[model samples]
Target chain A: MNLRFQATKARTSSLVLVSPALVLLGLLFFYPILLLFFTTLEGENIGNYAQVVNSGTSMQVFLNTLRIAAIVTVVDLVLAYPLAIYISRLSPAGKAIALFLVLIPLWTSQLVRTYAWMVLLGRQGPINNMLIWLGVIDAPIRLANSEFAVVAGMTHILLPYMLLPIYNSVSKIDNSLFDAARGLGAGAFSTFTRVLVPLSIQGVLAGVSLVLVLSLGVFIMPALLGGGRVPVIALLIEQQAGSFLNWAMAGTLSAILMVIVMITFLIIKFATRMFVRGRIDVAST
Target chain B: MPDLRNTSALKLESIRKTFGRVDALTSINLEVNAGEFLTILGPSGSGKTTLLRLIAGFVTPDSGRLAIFGKDMTMASAGKREIGMVFQHYALFPHLTVLENVMFPLEMRKHSRRDAADKASAALAAVRLDAFGDRYPKQLSGGQQQRVALARAVVFEPKLLLLDEPFSALDRRLRESMQREVKQLQASLNLTTIFITHDQEEALVMSDRIAVIDRGTIQQLGTPNEIYYHPRSITVAQFIGESNILEGTETPEGLRTSSGMLLRRASPSTSGRVLVRPEAIRITREPATGGATNQFKGKIASRTFVGGFTIYQVDVYGGDTLTVRCLADEGSMFEASQEVNLSIREADCRPVPQDAKDAGA
Candidate 1:
């Protein structure tokens, strides 16, 4: 009886200790979101949401955002997987060097990295100069302010996110499994597809979801590389808040993007839960 | 590639492997007979696992010739060699069900799904795991997982099966049962198997022939009895079981011990050490007479009860300390500090060459 009372008292004290952080988070983060939601509903009522949905330019911008995010996620996956595998198989010194290369870009500011791509993709940049010097083209080509430029920039920025997780999972795998698979009469391709790829699926899922969600909310890459040609949801929200001073429309757009991000989070969580469950079927034999 | 000879299932000629500067295996020449259970026994870092990996095609020898079933497989890839291996850790695919793991080899060979499933089920049943086909590897016990690995390896009926200390992870009772199960499985299938282990008792219990390996080479390769009773060197005798080694010079009758006691030998040799098994020596209160050619007086220094036997450490009157194992008969107990005579048959003492001793050191 005394133990039960002490346990309850301990639980109450733990809760009291954690309540300050909870209250701080609620006040600093969630309270602002609640205020933003209310501001969207003020005066305009449902018309702001209707405007976000019905505006053809807004619709195209939303679709273009999804398209660019999807392309960036795919391009990052394709580029990161082989590089992650290569890094996972390297010698100790080689692995250190490879991981250093993957991480050095991340230490730089995201804006600076995006602008560096701008310098490289410009008509007067070294790429165009090289093309002309090689006689591949008679004139410097227009490479900046394009969707391709935005994707290239974003893929470069998000690649380490994809590569690190995949590298972690790949490195965790026992090399003996590869030997066992090959010893079981599996060719190199068969061993990789049947054994290595399936085992690393969780890492792939984590990386893809991270890249996808981050891509959806991307602002700087599109702003700097797209140069207003590739306006996405974040840019639309920026225009409503900054140039137009339409706070209601901006809040409504912000609420929609938040909902989309939340839905993506839910889908990814559900998919990961399913995949993990499938991987470990703990049944009594 | 030349055709393999019918008599030998696997052959290794002058196999040498070096890792940067360290020699993992050197001058490893051996031939495994068809359907024979050959065990490579050694302590850790003794090149047993290296030899096994070489046979499995996981590690290529720096210089050697390897042939399987009359075909030269020196440069063949692991998949092309048609060899099966059960790794020390089992190495079952965590994401795959037991049935799928067993069916992997068949699937790789392009068998139809239905056919592969049927064969995999048969293999699982053989390992007594038919009902657990749908379960993942983590669901099974260590012994069950090992059996699953064994089933996966043998499902394709490869030319050779290599087991790399597969039972080292299990507890004592489970290890013994799994050893028996694997030996029985190997016999029933008539499969050629090369098993690697550091456990001497397991090698004696499971192998048709045992190769005692150390320092990147095979020290001795023979039948279990040959390895135990007639070890080629003092190192082999010491590694395989308990032995008391008496260093001495050769005399007319036998070996002259450093302490001046003469130990009789069936065939006299110039100079070497004599290895005497502890159990081979007989201890008595008075000097033992007749048929036994060598006798010494000693006082018991200590006694240890080891379940079935009482090991007595006897300090001989001359200089050497001899360990004598006596069967645990309560009535025949010898107390510490009691003087006793130790008698050993002349033929039982083995003379180990000085060069082999130096090589072992």
Candidate 2:
């Protein structure tokens, strides 16, 4: 009886310690998601959803946002992998320097970073001024308030996020593993492809998922750097809620966007779980 | 490429490895024969693992040459060297099943996957693990993981096998059993093996020749019997087995003890110190029955009774202690502070080896 009482006491204390974080998470994050889903069901008769779903403008905005997110994610990975390798190979002092450099952009507000991109990418920015100076063009190139400008800003904000997780993962890989592979006759490319890349899949998935999910909800970058012409799903929701004052329609479109985002996340999560945990030859063997 | 299995031997000539400022190996030199089981025995931080890693091509030496079969292989890559390594942790890929781990080298050697799988099955069967091919390394016990590591290392048929304290993690029984298994397998396959271990018993039991290493250098190399009975240095005698080394003084009327006892010279004791194995000393009840060259009067200080043998610590005068290995079945009369006569023949003791001076220096 005393043993049973002690066991219960231990479990009760463990649950108590975990309860505060769980409560905060449920209220702050999970509650809003639940409410968002409930509002989708609350509006009278699929009428609000039908209006948002049938709108061609909403469809175009969704595609445009998706295209930007996909392109940015791919480009970000290409730039981040080498930088991650550089950081992972650095000495302790060099590592400190690399970490400071990576985190420096994160210190300021993300919106301010996007505005910095605006100064660099504007019509008379350094790129055009350089081109004019070099006699490559007669006039300054029209650069700002375009899709390119929004992509530039989004990439800048999200590049460090992708680099850090990958750097941490790559750094933890036992260097002897690469030596072992090479000793066993694996060429450089094969070693990287088979061993290094597979081992670092957790970081790849983390960086990809973080960048994709974060870019989907991006508002200020598109609103400020991107002219009002290049409309995104966030812009559409703003139009519906602020201008049309159609809260129900905004909620329905948000539900659709949330579904799309969840589908992408499900694919990534399922693939990552299989990539890391699934026996590489579960069925074939 | 060098023929690693050719009848000659592996020689590391003045091999030196330094990382930036720290010297890991300094002017190291050694030779391992084609099929001989040579163990690099050392305590931790003695650079034995670094030496193995250098030969395995995991790290390139900063200077000097490594020759296998008369071909200089100092700068050769690991794939070209074909040295198989068994890690202390076994290092079986956690994600791979037992059979897949064995087949990895075969696949790396460009064998067809189907053929590799068949050979892997045979290798696993050799280690008596055929029935466990479906289990991952983590699912197996420590002994099982060690066998899988063995199977993985041997499946490729590498000419040289390097084991870095492979059995340091097993229980005593398991270690003994695995040591027997590894010795039998190595003899059957005729593969040259270099085992690195700090455990003296494991080295004595498993190695045909044990190389005692200390502070990044080989102190002595000899057979187990030779190392135990005829040790070169005090360190080797102490490291390999129990012994009693007395610091002698050359005085009038022969080599005498600190407490005015006369002992006959053994093998020209010009060197100030002499080493003697504990078992070589003969303890008898009668004082002058035999014409023993050396004799001393002492009292048993302590008796530790192990099952097979009892070790007696005798306090000899002039502040020197002597250890005696008595057989459990000796039926010898002995007790604490019991006055006894200790005698050793002139043939059993000698001046410590020259390497002992370097070790001391």
Chain B alone, TM-score of each model? 0.95, 0.91
Residue A155 of model 2, lDDT score: 89
- lDDT, candidates in the order shown: 0.89, 0.81
TM-score of 2: 0.87
Task: Give the Cα error of residue B323 in candidate 1, in Å.
Answer: 1.9
Best by lDDT: 1
| B277-322: candidate 1 lDDT, tens digit per residue | 9999999998887975788999999999998999999999976999
Per-residue lDDT over A135-219 for candidate 1, one digit per residue giving the tens place of the 0 to 100 score: 9999989788988899999999999999999999999999999988888877778877888888887898899889999999999
TM-score of each: 0.94, 0.87
| Positional deviation of residue B25's Cα in model 2 after best superposition, in angstroms | 1.8
Top DockQ model:
1
> How is the predicted docking of candidate 2 categorized under the CAPRI scheme?
acceptable
User: How many Å off is the CA of B255 in candidate 2?
Assistant: 3.7
lDDT of 2 by residue, B206-322 (tens): 888988887777878888878777777767767887766666587654556565555565555665556667887776656746675677778889988898988888876654688
